[model samples]
Target: MKTIGVIGGMSWESSTEYYRLLNRHAKARLGGHHNARSLMLTVDFAPIEANQRAGNWTALGDQLADAARQLERGGADLVILATNTMHRVYESIEQAIDVPFLHIADPTGNALRAAGITRVGLLGTRYTMEQTFYTGRLSERYDLETLIPNEAERADVHRIIYDELCHGNVNDASRAVYQRVIDELAARGAQAVILGCTEITLLIKPEDSALPVFDTTALHAQAAVDWAIEPV
Candidate 1:
């Protein structure tokens, strides 16, 4: 199996999920005593978060590129960036490493296409929701149309992500808010909802949404496992 390199800890909460899902996927695919052959280089998110809020993506890109290079040097055959927001700098990381970089969006996009989902709701950091890097890729590559929560709801989603979810705090009140948001999106003609933030799955699950839930963290990790164990 190829070694999966992971750039993680943009928030350790979601990074833990990536690790769990990767091993779970590996075990489910390979049966007894099996797990993913992987290496995770976890960064300190304090400075990363500071840079994100300050709009210093150049520094973030350089930091992530260095992480990717470290993983490559450690014998990782492929790389996965564990956070959806950090993917804003995916191109720099991709360019910095020789290994195949598994973009967090591609797996979700492919699954949405196979399920015939044309229009989808997106929930993530304000940066991810408002910026072109993510939604633009979905439209350009997957022929998918993206919808997001209204401005107020977008603020709620972004706040919950950074303040609560990042700290591993899951409150029922927050979940209810997300449920209402999903219902609102469904009302707006969203065919499915992309849990575009990695930490979103910690708050909302498939059962809680008004539409189908595409959890990017799970899809990304599962895809990494599929790639790692592909026939040589």
Candidate 2:
């Protein structure tokens, strides 16, 4: 198995899921107590969050690039940024590492395409929703149409992610709020909802929404495993 390097702990909450899913999927696929060969570099999210709030993407990119470099030095064959929002710095991270930097959006787009999902609803941090880095890639690469909640709903979604979900606090009220947002997106012609935030899967499940839910976390992890186990 190839070593999968992870840039994680944008919030340890979601990073934990990435680690767990990687191991679980590997074990299931390989059988007989097999597990993933992985390396993880977890950073302090406080400063990263502060920089994000301040719109200091240059500094954020530098921080993430440093982490990716560390993973590469540690013998990682492929790197993954565990958070969706942090993928804004993907280019810098890619440049910092000699290994393959598997983009989170690529697998999500591929999964959506394989499912014949042409339009989908996106829920993530405000930066991810408002910026072109993510949605633009999806449109350009997969011919997918992305729909985001309106300003008001977007604020709520962002709040719930940072304030509650990142802290590992799951509230029924928050789930209800997300459900309403999903309903609005479906009304707007979304065939499925993309859980754009890595922590989002902790709250919303496929059964939670009326439409099919595309989970970027699972898709990204699965893609890594597929790459790791591919015939040489």
Question: CA lDDT, every prediction?
Answer: 0.95, 0.94
**Model 2 error, position 197 (Å):** 0.3
RMSD of 2: 0.9
Error of 2 at 149 (Å): 0.5
Considering only N, C-alpha and C atoms within 3 Å, which residue pairs clash in candidate 1?
A: none
lDDT by residue for model 2 (1-232), tens: 9999999997899999999999989998999999889999999999999999999999999999999999999999999999999899899998887888899999999999999999999999999999999999999999999999999999999999999999999999999999999999999999999999999999999889988998999999988987888823
Model 1 off-target regions past 4 Å?
A: none
For residues 44-123, could you state the per-residue lDDT of candidate 1 as single tens digits?
99999999989999999999999999999999999999999989999999999988999999999999999999999999
After the best TM-score superposition of candidate 1, give how far the Cα of residue 19 lies from its true spot, in angstroms: 0.8
| Candidates in order: C-alpha RMSD to true structure | 0.9, 0.9
Question: At residue 16, what lDDT does model 2 achieve?
Answer: 92
